[model samples]
Every structure is written in structure tokens, then in C-alpha cells.
Target chain A: MSLNDPVDDETLLEVRDLQKHFKVDEGLISSLLRAMTGSESDYVHAVDGVTFDLKRGETLGLAGESGCGKTTTGMSLVKLHEATDGSIRFRGTDLTDANEEEMVQFRQNAQMIFQDPFESLNPRMTVYDTIAEPLRIHDIRNETARVRRALEFAELQPPDQYFDQYPHELSGGQRQRVAIARALVLDPDFIVADEPVSMLDVSLRAGVLSLMERMTEEFDLSVVYISHDLSLLRHMCDRLAIMYMGKIVEKGPTEDVIEHPQHPYTRSLINAVPVPDPGVGRERVELAGEVGDAIDVPSGCRFHGRCSEYIGDICETEDPPLEAKADFDGSQKVACHLYEPAEGVDSTRVDDVTDTTAPDDSAASAND
Target chain B: MATQDEPSIFADLDDSTVDESEEQVNRWKRNLRLWRETLGEQWRMLTNDLLVKLAMVTMAFFMAVAIFAPFIAPHQPLNRQYETDAELIIADWVDPMFIDSESVYVLGTTAEGFDIFSQLIYGSRAALLVGLLAAVFTAGIGTLVGLTAGYYGGKIDDTLMRIVDFLYGMPLLPTVIILVALLGPSLWNIIFAIIVLQWRSTARVIRSQALSLRERPFVKAAQVAGASDWHIISRHLAPNVLPMSFLYGAFAIAWAILAEAGVSFIGLGDPNRVSWGTMLQSSRAYAALDFGVWWWFVPPGICIGLVVISGFLIGRGYEEITNPELR
Candidate 1:
């Protein structure tokens, strides 16, 4: 995706070809030697090329396993990590090239909720100061009243009770609430909640998620929820986008992606989640290899190395673009060679697909 | 849905509601209460350590001597009496009243008849002045360098850290002495030299902390909250790194005191000042070690050792607070 794509009138954020690559710092002597030798520095392509769009009051789930760059994509939305390349057009302004003045305006409108509440809230700042900080930064008046309202909004009753309390004094749930309050105090139009309840107790997860749901509705906010937890994503997100090694392999409505995952990577991920009923047996397509280092990502298809249904040389030689398959509806997009258009009728590819479909067609072809 | 109505486990923790009446309390009383609530625990932890308690007592005593030196010392530190020396009297342990009824020297006098006790009392003022002032300046410079290096890391971090490495490579004492000699011998010059030499260690330590602190989620959250680089460094990064700054500041005091002593002992100290190092230097020149004029040299040597040790003990005590893993 690039800036040439048409934007919808309701779109709140349009990220196109976003990429963030971090330089691998090989110690002092090695770097110096490399510099002297005129060797190119190596980079870890954490987020290779991510593109997505969110409309007003929409919650898009970014689901991937750990180290898949979902968090990096989330952070880049708020300009916490400047995109090494590509454009993040929030509202009408391109955030990647925003100046200080524009960045301040953007920052006032977009906020982020981090994954770990323990580490996200400043330990030294009181709950009141934590919530009041953004107000003070924006030069908004009546900080005390807004902070108190935010506290009450987060369901911490009697708002004043938490004013003087520090992060260490609060429980995990309460700390997350304060973090949410801080994010909401600005009355931002957009928010990126990066696994907001991942670090909390399982018992308290629902409360926090429900609070976030209420905040999104009441404040009319656009949210991007990034998580590795598929169950949580299914529960909270309206649409789901599955990521694999810094690239979005599949994206569609949440229920469609969950029930009818098209990509091999997404299929493996869904199969990996255990079923509670012992009587119902499910086939597990165990992937072959572990996730490779981002410094040297696999060529062709990033997931081809671990794919169970390795079809032909095409999967090894040609990278597949993310597009809607000929068979599936246009809303669901998948990046896999198996779903290529019918016009490219190679005999070897046809034979391979038939052979692969013989055993698993009953279970895998249910959506078809 | 039933669980939603149930009182949360945290309901009991909500008892300490903010009292509206307390807002009307006097500022002095409020500040005092604030201090007790915030710093009182750390102070209690420090005092609980026996070594830190001893260090605090020793430091307090030295500070008292420095502050009340004029009223406490019986004679002026620079006063000398050469008139009674013609008799070729080697030494007398008697009070100064015997020779001159109006004068009193508790620890007798030096070879030039300068008052030993008065010099010892007055010397602490210079030692502490250099130590405390150098410490404050070193920590300030170190914090700024570290905060800048850690926050804007990349070429800026590389350049600042390389400078720290260069400073770290120099031999501290000789380098400080050379700089002090070039700057001219004075208390401010010595403090300046000590600051230049000692700040690198604090800078390096704080930079590593800032390196980690800048990556912390809270700092990133602060960045997302519209904080500028200056705002993030001063408000988020600096406060988190402050306890470490203070911890290094204590160690910087010890280093500066020793550096000042080394400079003064080499005869580069301020000529007009009566520092403990100058006292030892003058006594050495007069061959007090061989002549057994213990009063002239021993007090200054012991005083230097006591103050440096006190500073180290306090620093060690603070280490536990900053890094609980050390405890």
C-alpha cells in the first residue's frame, strides 16, 4: 500500500508502506573497522512494510506472535518510533514528515496505551500528575477537574482518593486504569492501545477491556489494538489483521479471519490455540522452522521456510502479494502462492495443490 | 455479568481518601509532612546501616567544626609568635598562657608557632567547600551530559560517550594537579579542576542508566504525550535517574576531597588558605615527621581519612536504595 490509494471519508488514520529498521550496533572496534573498510552497516528490519487503515470509532486488531513487529507498528502510529520510511497520514496530515508544531498538534490528538502498565506509568509520578501531564503539556486549563473526571471515567471511584498515590502503591489493574486515564485526559481522537491488558491478571483483563470499549464509544476514538493473544483480539477487536515477520499476511473481518484463515501462517496460528473440548479432535499443521532473525529475513515468501504445504519453486523463488484470492470474497486478503489467480495454470502447481488437498480438504476447505 | 457488580479486590485499598480540609493546612506543615512521607523511609533505611550512621556522625562533626570554627577555636589559625624563639627551646607541651598570659593554644604550636588546633579547625572549611561545591557541579554536568547522550542516542551518544572515555583514560590526580597549576592555585580553581576530572565517572554511570531509562515504556509514553526532548529529559528521564545521580554525587564528593588534598599536598593549593593538605605540607617541609611534631601533621592526616571514608560510607549506603539488588 502507498499514498496513491484512495482514502475513505471516514478514515481517521491511513498508514502506507510503513517501515522501521534499527541498525545493529556491532561493538566499538568492529563498527570502527567496518567504517574503515567502507562496509555497509547491517539493519534489523523490525517492521518491513506495514499498511492498514482505520475509520472513525473503529478498533482494528493487529495479531501476531511475539517478535512479529505488531508492537513496532503500534508505536509508529503514535510517532513514538519514527518510521524509517513511508507515510503515516493521520486525519489529513502526514505524520512522518510533520514538524515540531504539527507533531505537537498530532500528539494532542493521538495517544498510546502501552502493554505493561507496571513499566508504562512513571513510578515517581502520582496518579494525579500522571493524568494531568498531557493537560499541562497542551496548556489546557482546569487540570484538576479534567484529571478527576478521567479518574472517575476509568472507574477509580472518589477520584481524589488516587490523586496522591504513586504507581508502586497501586495494583496492576489500578495502574493500567491510571495509564488509560492519562491517555484519555487529552480527549484524543485516536488511540493505539498496544496489548493494554497483556500484563494484568487474567481475572482483571475483562474489566480493563470493557473500560477501553466504553472509552472508545464515549469519546468517539479510533483505536488500533495490537496483541499476540488471539483470544483477546477476537474478544475486543472489530477486524483482525494477522502479521508474520513484520508483514501483514492476512486481514479481514475478525470472525472471517478466525473462522476462515486463508494464509498458511494464520492457519498454523489458529490451530496452535488449544481447544477446550477433549472429545473434538483437530488436525495440527505443525510448522517446520522457528522464526528467523530479522537481520536476514527470508527471500521470496517470509513464511515459506516454515510452511507445511510447500507447493513448488514458485513459493521459494517468487514473493506473493497480499490480495483477495479468486475464491474468497474481496474483504478478506491473504498473502500465499496457493491462493494465486486461476489464469496462471501451471501443471506442476495444479498437481501439487490436488495432492495437498486430498487429505485435508474436508477440514481446510469448509469455507470454500 | 454478575462479576461486574461484585466489589473488586482493590476496594479495601481505597480508604485513604484525600481530605478537603487538609488542602487548607499551612504550607510549612504540608511540606514537612511531605518530606516525612517521601524521604523519611529512605532516611530510615540509611540510618539503619551501622556504617552509614557512623559516616553521618563523622560528617556532621566535620560540618559543625567548619561552621563554628571562628567561635570554637581559641586562637587565629594564621597567628604566629617568633619573638620567644631566641632562647633555642626545642619544644614545650605547656599551654600558650605560660609564655603569653593572654594567649591559649590547646594543641601547642607548629615550628613557626602557628596554632595547631586552630589550623585543624579552620582547615575543614576549605576541604568541605571544595568537596561540596565540586560535587554539586560535577553531578549537574554529568546529569546534563548523560541525559543528552542517553536520550538522543546515536551520533550524539557516540560523541559524548567517546569524550567520557577520553576523560576516563587520563590519570585523575596528576591531570587535576596539572589543570589546577595551569588555572592558578585557588579554591575555585581546585573545585573547577576536580569537577572536570570527576564528572566523567558520574557521566558514564548516568549515561548507562539513561540508556536503559530512555528505552523504558514510561519515557516512550511521555514522548507520545507531546513532550519535547527537553521536557522528556528533565521531567521523565532526569527524575528517574536522580537517585543514581545522588548516589554518584556522594562518591564524587569523596573523589573531589581526595583530589583537592592531593593538589594541596603538592604545594599547588591556594597559598592563602589553611587546608588540611596545606597543614600537612607545611609540617612536612618543617621536618615534623622526623622532629616528632605529631600535633602539626597527625590531625590533618586523620581528618582527611575520616572525611573521605565518611563520604564513601554514605555512597555505599545509597547504593542499596538505588539498586535494591545490592542489598
Candidate 2:
């Protein structure tokens, strides 16, 4: 797990310090009519210096609140959103510099599953055609065969019955299964599934999640599963990264991070997950203020404004670098001053373990 | 031991069951069935709508007449020398006295010996051609510009939107008049004027839709699927925007037809070709009111009203078909 352990030879994808900044501008004439209309401009640093690597057949969960840039980071990996800086190496080929043709080849190996079941499938396309579309684009001449294979992989039995079905005719879960089938038709090795089950009903969500889980194993697929649902991430991911304000606040083995989160933001997120046990009541760590805009991220630690345990000076003036906490098995990393070893603070106190309790069985899991 | 070692016939069935391709085929077939079901639903909704059915009938009738104007009309309107002269063309076809002229015109005759009924029938050909062609021109140009601006955004969006603003500022009627004067009063010239003057509105509407559609999860899905910009625009974006384009195209055609008539009424259309507007102009010039010749003005006015009203009805029908929220 250490950085020097000859970086996993099985690593299928690697993202290093990726960033995407969108520039907001004023209307056309106002900006053009006068050289200086003083049209104030701002940059939304959607994915700011996010770094991660995906091992072959491993599911790395990107858990974060909305607007934390997990989706943007996922997009940058496939060259969907052009990265402002940094390198995305897919099978050792740098995606940041890959021309359109190179990216097309890269796409054969990497694909994506979107968040919404309602809107993700093209309404104009039938199920058969929707799944066949990728095969056509990729020049898979045996489109019927490939589509059939993909639909099978998605577990939609008696595929003939649903071949001509449109999105609206299918239930929410069925639509998502079709979306997954479309993605799987290409036989891609890697996938960025951005909250693929977020739009489904509670009952249907588990079915899609389980299907994805089974497919991941059956296909030997490497995936970056992005979602704000911590429990679901626990169920599906091998390693999980907690993102806050477009930065990875903490990341490690799923069990390790959830059981022992080093960053205060990660701790708060873990604390917020409701437990389903009647005997024990869980303590909630409510976030202090609203999330600051991406354009004006706080100076030092982006979470300083919202961190309840913030120590004034260092938290504001100096940014904390992502470093390994001692208790972690060398794989875990956290970016917070609280985890940083201090002169007066004892090493044991540095962990700052919080009271962990299970929630009442009667309490429903809060929707993220 | 022999029985246990023997291979079972059901092994082949099990193999087929586990065959990945077969499973996929089944899934695909199921999805297709579902899609057809949805389309069936949409069709049922469309058929049940009274307004939609009416519009469809009106459009079908107009288009049929426009297409077969030569065969359907008793006298060829464009062929002025066809048996009927102006006096015979508009006379009542059922009357023995009118039919006795042997130059039978189903509708009637104009004041200047031109066939009023024939002219009206032929005039439809010109009106429909201009309206349809102008709509194509406007929709094509507007959709291209709007898609690029909304998709790429930033500087391109700003610049394109400014151009739209400038066009919006200009008075459409005066601008069309000036352009027509410079370009000369021809049918094609009039169509060109209508397209140029009207494209701005289409672009504005398309841009607004594009702005919203561009952000949809499906658009993002296409992007992450590694679809090129052209692929995304044509496949993902175009299908979503097409219904809107068709809806707006209908409205644009209506506008173009009105503009064509307006120009012709002002005596700016092809001088040789007969149109409803020419009939109006000539009727006014001849002082129809003073002579008590109601036939000249009334027939042409009624033709114009029928076309415009039908166009509006058809456009409404299309809106209902594409927009489920409206239904």
C-alpha cells in the first residue's frame, strides 16, 4: 500500500493532480462593446488537484456531497471534460495530451454510466437500438450479436421481449438496466458510474446496485463509483475517497476510513450516516455553514470555514498537504491540520477518535 | 456408476442458458418491446386529441391540393391562355349560363379577364413552396448556430447571442422591405428576405432549449461515452431538439407566408406570376368598391384566411404531439 511499493502493476487507470476550472463570463455585447465594461469574471474549480488510481478489477468509491467535483473528476478521466491541468494515464497513455483519435481508442476501453434513469436513455431510441448504437459507432459489425451479449450481461432475460421497448415503457429500474446494458455492450474494462442508482426508487436501487456488483465481478471491471450514499459505498467499494470542496479530504480502505476517519470533514460525513439499530443511538455531526462557492474556495483548508474543531491561525493561513496518518496501513491519506503531528499534542490524541454509535432500528436512513 | 457417468440431454439446454449472447439478445428484445409500447402510448395520445386530428386533416388537405394543383384545378391558373379567360374562370361552374361559355372556370373571373379561381389554385403552389423553403433555411441556420453556442459556450455563446440581439433590435418589416428593394422583387428574393429576417427568432428559441438540453444527464452520458462533438450534436442533441425545431419551423412557415403576401400586396412580388396578393392589389387599383365588384377581393381574402388559419392549427397540433407536458 505504500507509494514505493512499485505502483500496482495491475493499475488500469491513474489520475494525477487533475483540475477543471470553468470560466463564467458576461453577455456578448457588454464584454465586446467596451474594452473594460468591468464584467467581473469567476472560475469554478470543479476538480481541483484530484489524484487517484484504479487497479484492475477494483471498485474505488468516490463519496462526496453534491458539487464536491467527484463527477467532474470522473468526467476528466475519460476526456469528457477537458482537464485544466494534470495527467490522466489510461493504460499508460496520457489522456490529457491525447488527440481526438487517441481518445476514441481510449473510449473502447473506458465507458460511463450516468446518474439518471429517466433522462439518461435517449427517449427517441428503442432499447435494441440504444444498446446497438455503441456497437455501430465502434464498428462492431456483428451488432446483433454484441447487443445480445450486452443485454445478457445486464441480466435482462428474454431480451427479445424488450428489444423494441422505449425508455418510457420501462420502469425506473428497467431503464437503468438498459443504460448499464448499453455501457456493457462495448466490453469496456473501466467505467465511471456517477451516482447511477440515485434516481431510482428505494426498492429498485438495491437491485441495480446488486446487478452492478455482479457485473463488476463477472466482467473483471475496474470502476470508480461516485455517490454521496456512504452505506451503499460501503457495500460496493473496496477503497473509498471522501471528497469535500473539490478536494479529497480522506481516502483509504473502505472499512478503515469508515471506522477511523482522520479528517474532520470525513469524520462528520461518517458520523452523519444513520444506523439501523434500536438499542444504540448515533451522534450526528451537523456541518456548521453552507458549502462555499467553488469560485471562492476558502484560503487554506477548504473545509476550515465549516470545520467545528478548526484552530484559528493555521487552519486559515496554511494549506494542509495530503499526508499519511500513522494508524493507516500506509494506504490511507488525509488532508487536515488536526491529523498533523504537533509539539504539545500526544501521538495517541492525534487520532482524535470520536464516539461511534449505531442508530435506532426505527430511524430511516436519510436520503443523501 | 454407469448411470452417474452418463451425460444428460439437458446439458445442452443448460449451456444455452448460460450463453452470454443469448441472454443479451433476450434483453435487447425485451427493451425493444418496451420502446414500442411507449410509442404506442404516444400514438394513442396523439389520435385521441381532437385539436391534433383537426390540424392533421387541415394540413393533409392543403398539402394534397398544393401537390396536385395542376390535375385538381379545372383550369390551370398559371396558364392564363387555358380555355378560360378572366371573365369565364371565376363564373359559377354549376350554372348552365356560366358553363355555356365553353371556357369553363370552376371558380370565376377577375375584372381584367383573368381567371380568379385558377389564379387562386396556382397561387397556393407559390405560397407553400416559399413557406416550406424559407422554414428549412431558417431552421438549418438557426439550429447550427444555436447548438454551437450552447454546447461550446463562453466566447462563442456571447458573440452569437449578441448577433441575435442586434437582429432582434432591428424592425423586421422595414428591414425586409429594404432588402427586397435592393434584391429586386422576386419569389426567391422574398423567401431569402423572410429567412434572413426570421432566423433570429428561431435561433433565440433554439439557444434557450439548447442551454437546458446541454446540461441534461443524457448529454453528459453521451460525452462520457466518448462521443465526439459532432456525434453528440447530431445524435444526442439533435433528437432532443428536433421536435422543437419542427414546432418552430411551422411557425416560421406561417410567418413567411404572411410576409410573402404582404410584399405582394405592396406590388413587390414577381410581376408575371399571379398570387392572392396580386389579386388584392389589382382589385384595389380597379376601385372594386365603386364598381360593386365584391368577387375580386372577397375570394382572394378568403383564400389567404384559410391558409393562415390552417397553418396555425397544424402548428398547434405538432406542439401537442412533441410536448407531453402540454398534453
Best by lDDT: 1
Q: Candidate 2 docking category? A: acceptable
| CA lDDT of each prediction against the hidden true structure | 0.81, 0.74
TM-score of each: 0.86, 0.82
Q: If you score just chain A, what TM-score does every candidate get?
A: 0.89, 0.87
C-alpha DockQ for predicted model 2: 0.24
Write the residue-wise lDDT of candidate 1 on B1-327 in tens digits.
001232222222332454434533532464466557779888998999999999999999999999999999876788664436574553333334445575556667887777788889999999999889988988899999998998889899999999999999899888878888798999888888888888898888888888998888988888888887888888888888999889888988888888888888889999888999998888888888897667778889999999999999999999999889999
Per-residue lDDT of candidate 2, residues A128-231 (tens digit):
87887776666555556666667776778878778777788999989999999888876778888989898999999888999999878766788899999999
Clash count, predicted structure 1: 0
lDDT of 1 by residue, A143-235 (tens): 566777889989999999898888999999999999999998877878999989989999999999999989887777788999988888898
Where model 1 places Cα greater than 4 Å from the true spot, the runs are A1-9, A27-39, A340-368, B1-36, B82-103, B325-327
